[model samples]
Target: MNRPLCIAHLYPDLLNLYADKGNILTLKRRLEWRGLEAQVTLVTSSEEARPGDYDLVLLGGGSDREQEIVSRTLRRSRDEWKAAVEDGLPLLAVCGGYQLLGEYYQLPDGTKVPGLELLDMVTVAGSPRLIGNVAIESDECGTIVGFENHGGRTTHHHAPLGKVISGHGNNGTDGHEGVRYKNVFGTYIHGPLLPKNPALADFILQTALDYAGIDVKLEPLDDELEKAARTAFQVRRMNLSEVAAQTP
Candidate 1:
């Protein structure tokens, strides 16, 4: 793609907890390092753009109330958004985003907020919020790291959204993690997953490249910088694990 890559950041109003916006910065920098210019565009309920305008779409984690707020707009533009995904557009949705993609999110008062149902899953509200860091090992992918913080538990009505390598996902129900289908990878992992796990980051970038039919070399970062990055990642993982172990 000759033009600078555009990323559609959906529901920034409610889906940016944990400063997940940092992930976008990490992605942008990584892409620029690989010689692909990147641009991030925000899309709220009031602002809707054509699917073809972006190379990637992102939905971050947010509060239940915020999720409901964003849902209003999502419900209105869901068809166009779904069409974009059907066309193989790249998407990365976090906790709130992940829940919104399911059939529906069961609220506390027996009320239900309808979801896009883009994936075969349902998020049911739970008590004693699930929070903490997680560790995951993907045979097809690799080691994955991130934190999970949510009160809703997701159940895979059909196939499991994804496998769990580490951490308490989907409310410790074994399906605690988010769903990943096609070029879309939805998870509860917070910001810094990209900076910590460069391999996964490259995987995402490669997915976009593959979709665009672009072949590019995966330039390796300097050994010193790579080690420092991994060390920081490990430290975070260990700390979270320790905290979770002591939570009870």
Candidate 2:
């Protein structure tokens, strides 16, 4: 019998701006389908993040104001989180959460949002938000698809999560999409991210399981619909690119 997978969802009420709850649902359902049990604990602003109690940690996007609030809340327990990540806790942080995991994020008005310094990166907010369907070739996973919408351009000094294939990733000039540090992954893409990329989801799950000393292999599921959705998005992205090319 496989041990139950425990997931810690950080700030669900404050940081779920982009249907990020879908990520939790996707992870839980996938585990259930494979006959494995999943337990998700919502860690709010009032609660401390105990990484050792969970197999995986999830942080989602939020508004700038919410990000500030969350940042302040996290500061109280920064050492706990830092130690957790260093101990190989699997983490997935998207958009605002991604920025918060970095060194800092500078707002357009020159205000600075201090990060946990967990990842060696910085995000600077600028004009013309990168909003569109995105595709990338991840070094750890494979082809990944999602949507990106952010004015903050992230520049990382560490290994990137993936190279941009059909979207403006990171700063739009670096051709990188996200950052990967140890078992933690950060990205700007969030069509809830996981439903269309089962491979990436499984990678995260397996990594978390492995860290927990659970050696059970995840059996494959019927991903026909998931593949079709990914293909459709790829086709649409290609068409859009072609149209832009012919615009001149």
Candidate 3:
């Protein structure tokens, strides 16, 4: 019997400010729809999260205080995460999770929130939070869309996931949206991320499959509903673009 692909959702309780569990659900069902099995394990504490137990990992967004709580567990399990990434374990980290994976996330008052150094990046708190719908053009995944609501401006050294097509990305000034280093993906777009972006979801799945050396080919899924969702957003994006063009 084939074993199911295991996924670890770290600090799910504390890091689910944007209902990111939908990202988990998206992965799980995408597998099942292809006649494959996927098992998601919620890992809230360091002790329960064994490094070698998962094929992939997900770290969702959270508020500053919530992230502070998760950071303790991450510190305790930092070695495991670092090792896993080195060994090519696929990881998707969003917003606060993304910030924590970097060098530091500095607060407005100049307090430095320590990071795991998993990604070579830094974030500084900024005024006028970037909050809106986002669309980015990615060579790997076409036009990816999501929502962003953050006060931290992040600067990183790596190939970004995509160029900003619609809203404020890592920083409002830079036209980049997210970071892609090896198999780890860090993004600020939440709105539960993976639901409408099937291409990005499958890219993550494919990377996990490759990491695990699983040779099974993932069959294409019918995504009419997902297409409908994207169509609606595309119209809204156009309207926003028109509005921006008319602005001073």
Clashes of each: 3, 0, 0
Q: Go through the candidates in order and give the C-alpha RMSD of each one to the true structure.
A: 2.9, 1.0, 1.4
Residue by residue across 1-248, what tens digits does model 3's lDDT show?
55688898988878898888999999999999988899889987444577688899998998888877777667777888788888888999999999998988898889888888888899999999999999999989999998999999999989999999889999999899999988999999889899989999999999998887778778889999999999998998899889999999
Off by over 4 Å in 2: none
Each candidate's lDDT (Cα)?
0.74, 0.91, 0.89
Instruction: Estimate the lDDT of model 2.
Output: 0.91
Model 1 Cα lDDT, one tens digit per residue, 1-248: 46666777886766788676877887888888778877789886678656778778778888888888877777776788788788898888888887888889999887788888777878888898877767666544576776677888887654333467666776686643666676677777775456666777777776776666566656875446755866786787778678878997
Give the local distance difference test score of model 3. 0.89
After aligning candidate 2 to the native by TM-score, how far in Å is the CA of 236 from where it should be? 0.6
Instruction: For model 1, state the Cα shift of residue 49 in Å.
Output: 3.8
> On residues 149-247, what C-alpha lDDT tens digit does candidate 2 reach at each position?
999999989888899998899989989998899999999999799999999999999998899888778988999999999999989989998999999
Report the lDDT of model 2 for residue 183: 95
Candidates 1 and 2 compared by TM-score, better number = 2
